[model samples]
Target: MFFAVIPAGGSGTRLWPLSRAGHPKFLHPLTGTDASLLQATVERVAPLASADRTMVVTGVAHVTAVARQLAGLPEENILVEPSPRDSCAAIALAAAVIAVREPDAVMGSFAADHLIVDPNRWVETVRQAIVGAEQGLLMTVGITPTRAETGYGYLQCGPLIDGGPLRRVEEFKEKPAADIAEAYVRSGRYLWNASMFVWRVDVFMAELARQQPELHAGVTAIAAAWNTPEREDVLGTVWPTLTKISVDYAVMEGAAEAGRVATVPGDFGWNDIGDFHTLGEVLPADSSGNVVLGGEGTEKPGALLWDTANLVVVPYSNRLVAALGVRDLIVVDTPDALMICPRDRAQDVKKLVDELKSRGEEGYV
Candidate 1:
């Protein structure tokens, strides 16, 4: 049996106003489908791991919302974090807890905010990655780069082992300059690191101990008390002590350097749905290339797009929004705040959130 972990953190500040601390982007119906991004992720992995076996590691604040959305999952499967630590602690906790039940089970870590257009291809790709995990190598499902993406990190891959699809991960590159991103795409040896990983519980814990011993110990101790009356007490005390670092830095990178890492290229039409512009891709667009999301329909809430092509208007509020001669723009309207920027500036929306914090606009943020 394969256990799946969904780390549902991140406020998604880039998709802000619509995505807030209370309701992150993962909780919204960004894909135009009825299911929210988190719900879609759970459903996507349900074929491998049942609802009872799948676990969601999210902050205590989002626990209630996550539970409401994933009512099919067992209540205990929702692992609540006391505070924001990072992916290492979140994944480690789930891995250690599952190890207590089934030490040898293959566990896959998938993000809660990603979109996989082809579910069949996703399952098949994961099955391939699982095969690599059986060889005692850490495996990640690397999205085949479709374009020169400067926002996401890239993984340089080596020759395939045994003439199979699985290839050795040569290196993990951080988000690079535009020219470097284009070069990576042109080289054809890089894959976008989507943070999708599959490994056995025992193997993952062993690597966690080797790379991040303190985090491993902390999670192990907390997981030991998970079923007991001391679960909350132990977690509250030890979770904070776990080092605040990503699994990539604490484990995957070191594992890659040690030749203990491999990757399977997945061309499953994967998109992170990071910002409004990306979200527009998943949503339906009109003849004029204007995408409308939430609130009433395009005609009702009056998302009047006059000579507007390639505009993403999220009319989250009841108020009407009208755009005149706008092209390649994103307009997100919310009750508390409103944001308008060009499509190219979608990544810089996080900068706006930072500036808002600096300006003491905490309520809006």
Candidate 2:
């Protein structure tokens, strides 16, 4: 059997204004539908498992929103985190939950805000990962890079597996500089790290025990208390104290050291939808190369844009915005805040968010 878990605990400050407190990006309608990212993620994983087999691990703050967005999923499948621990602890909690349910089931972990357009290819790739997991291999799905993007992690591809299309992972690299990213794109030897992982319950738990003993203790407690009232209370207490670490840093890196990690190059039209820069790539644009989202006056509604080219206007409301003699600029307006910056500087919006937070302007966010 196959099970899927989604981790949705991050505060998406990169997409500020629209993504505010108590409402993260996963709940935002980024796909031009009523379906949020969490909904889309659930739909993508639903075909791989039974209704009860899918789980969503998120923080307590967003539990209500998560519930409302994913009403199609079972209420018990929602695992609420009591505090802000990182991905390693979240994955441990998921593993413990699944271990109690199915002692030897194969499971896959994904993020709630990823965009995979081709469902058929995604299902096939997941099946391939499950096969790899049953053989006791920790599998990670990597995307073939289409551009020289320095924003994502990369994986060095090794030789192909003996009987399958999957490849052994030679190494993992963090986000690199522009030149290095371009060189990687030219070499065709690396794939963007999608953070998609698959492993069997027993294999995953054993690897956790070996590499992360402290986290292993937390997992042990949760597994021991499964189906009992103590599971939630004990996990709430122990999980917050867990070391904040990435699963890649804690498990995959060590697994690579032990020569047990593998990679499957999956081209399912994957996108993390992480930032505005990436969102622009997926959204529609005018002839002027402008991409707008989640608001009106997208292209100067009932107005004009004379002598303007390559401008993105994302108004928060139906307010009319007129632009003249502007090019390569992003104008995002909300009721509480308005942002106008060159498209090239869009990636640095995080710095602006930090400044806003330092100034105690939480309402703007």
Candidate 3:
């Protein structure tokens, strides 16, 4: 059996303006759907884990909203952290809780803010990854790169394992330069690292202990007090002591080096929504190549375009947004802020968020 866990906590600074500290992008309907991204993520895994068995690890700030969005899930299943401790701590906390209930349970960790167009194929990919989990191998679902993407890390795949779809992960490569990303796609042996992981509860804990003992210990202590009255006291005391790092640097990369990691190629359409440009790709576009994300709290500003090609407009506010003679631009409109940048500079949004904090304009961040 599989128990799904969603680490529903990220500032999503890249998708800022629309994605804010109060209401992140994961709480928004970025996929041109009525359901929010977090709801879609859980519904996608309903067959694998029911509401009782499923869990969500989120920050204390987002706990209320996370619970409101996932009303079907048990309130106790929402593991609230004292503060942001990165993916390693978030996932470790969920793994520890699952380990307490079902020592041999297989668990899959999915981000709260990603999109997969082909849900059925995604289920199949996870099912295959579960096969790898049963073998005590840490597995990640790697998306087949459709193009040269410099934003995502690449997984160098080795030979097949046990004559199955699973392949030994030769190495975990970080996000590469444009030329290197292109070469990786052309080599026919690389897949975009989507950060989707699956493993038995005990197996993942064992690997986590081997690679990040301190993190393992902290989460274990928190989980021990999870259901008790000391839950808040223990979490507030221990969570901040854990190292702040991503699972990639803390575990996945090292496990791959030990030949205990594997990758399952995912043919399903997947999008990390890293920036406005990527969000534009999955959205419906007009003949002029202008995509507008409107409606649902955001009135249709009715973006007018002339000779514009590849424009991503997020009209979050009621104000009218108009563009003319623009090409490959990203225009995000919020109630308090409006951000305009070239499509290529989509990654710079995070810098803008940092600059806002540096200038003490955290009210906008």
**lDDT agreement with native, every candidate:** 0.90, 0.82, 0.90
Off by over 4 Å in 1: 295-306
- Error (Å) of candidate 2 at residue 311 is 3.9
Q: Estimate each model's TM-score.
A: 0.93, 0.90, 0.92
* Candidate 2 per-residue C-alpha lDDT over 1-365 given as tens digits, one digit per residue, 9 for 90 to 100: 88899998776776766677767888876764546788888888888987699999999899999988887789988988888778988888889889888899889999998877787899899888888899999999989999998889999878889965888887888999999999998998899999999999789889999999989888778768867978778876787779889999998888877878888888888877766666777767677776656534233243356778777666555576778898888776666777777778777777788888899987676
Clashes of each: 0, 0, 0
| Model 1 residue 239 lDDT score | 86
**Candidate 2 structure lDDT:** 0.82
Residue-wise lDDT of candidate 1 within 155-260, one digit each (tens)?
A: 9999999997999999999999999999999999999999999998899899989988888899999989999999989988998898999999889999899888
Q: Of the candidates shown, which would achieve the greatest TM-score relative to the real structure? A: 1
Error of 2 at 74 (Å): 1.0
Predictions ranked by TM-score, top down? Answer: 1, 3, 2
On the 0 to 100 scale, the lDDT of residue 207 in model 2 is 94
